[model samples]
Target: MRVEDSPLIDFIREEHRFSFGTFYFFDNFIISEINEGELFDWNKASEVIRVGQEFYGEEGQINYISNRIHDYAIKPQDWLRFLYERQLFKTFAVVTYRKTAIYNLVIERFFYKGDIFSFDSLLEAVNFIREQNALEPANDFDKLTQLYNDNSL
Candidate 1:
């Protein structure tokens, strides 16, 4: 079912479909659901990040959630790209019921520096993000500068 048909419609502010996945953008975060058996490489990951930049611009500090409702795999090299570009997200959350996915997330967390959380369902992940977002300042100049490194000035 599309996000609009699902309960997420209320929480999602916008949605975009890419070549390999769909992005559900929320007020303070985004959820990406990759297509089944999709091969996520550095190029694809870059495209996704680019879309996020366009949607939120350089000033937004958004949390990210990967809703792994369908099976997919990322290229090994993409891990380095993800690690290097971790600043694209304030926190990373992965949702999956599959054991293998959970194991992979555990391994990924070892190399990821920022906060990473795993959940068995999308609702749980969104709830956690909402709670975290509530605690964060709406527009703290220092926090924004530190997170986004606003070098435009």
Candidate 2:
């Protein structure tokens, strides 16, 4: 379900709209809905990071959710730049049912330094984020792998 249709909207503490997309900031996570047909590259990613810091502060550890409600082109390789800049996230979740998005996610995994989770539903993604305990390391590789394997996302 789209974020707007989910109860998630009630939790959004701040919202930012750009030409490329909209960002919904919550207590523990931020949901991004990029515009259709837009190219999501490093330049656009910079804006996201800047605004996110404005809300959550630079030291905050918030999970990320790419709520892909519309078709868009993303530079999966830009993840390298994201990592190179030393930015980190507790978890990165993608909400998309498209086969192509899943395939692209596979490519993104190679560049992303942290684990990425995929879910067909927005609620599932939010639940997964909520389950994460931010005080501890989120490197429970086996458990995380099992969860994704079970979902086949």
Candidate 3:
């Protein structure tokens, strides 16, 4: 299914312009897919935090999933700010197919203070979160996988 066609999109608020990527927000987590070659820094990070507050309210703690679908860079200095906003996230997950992205994740692990998990697919990421939070597993996992495979290229 196309992103526009996925029912999942209906529950997710999209914050795309400010961060130079597609950010999908659910009640408890945010999934961010970095735009190709985008430089994610303090300015964009601030917008993300602001948007998260708007979606989840000021006191809510959210999980985060980085869908590393494209190559990008994160400013190391901005990690300090991320540390401050660390309260906003209960856990962090990354899904990537690239070895280079895995290397980047290792570097990120040093700066981020939370449980971090890596997965090969979005479905696995979602399942991990569900398990962590004691939420029901997705009943249509196969359909979701097919939807992603069909539309994600």
The candidate that achieves the highest TM-score relative to the unseen native structure: 2
lDDT of candidate 3 at residue 87, scale 0 to 100: 63
Clashes of 3: 0
RMSD of each: 8.5, 7.9, 5.2
lDDT (C-alpha) at residue 95 in model 1: 88
The sequence of per-residue lDDT tens digits that candidate 3 reaches over residues 12-109 is 65555554887887655788887889889988888888877877788857888888888898887788677875567787889987898898888888
Give the poorly placed runs of model 3, Cα more than 4 Å off: 1-7, 13-16, 139-153
Ranking by lDDT: 2, 3, 1
User: What Cα-based lDDT does every candidate model obtain?
Assistant: 0.71, 0.76, 0.73
Write one digit per residue (lDDT tens) for candidate 2, span 95-148. Answer: 987877787778788888788899888767766775674322223434433443
For candidate 1, give the lDDT of residue 126: 61
- Provide backbone clash counts, one per model: 0, 0, 0
Cα displacement (Å) at residue 68, model 1: 0.6
**Model 3, residue 17: what's the lDDT?**
50
Worst 10 residues of 1 by lDDT: 144-153
Name the best candidate (by lDDT): 2
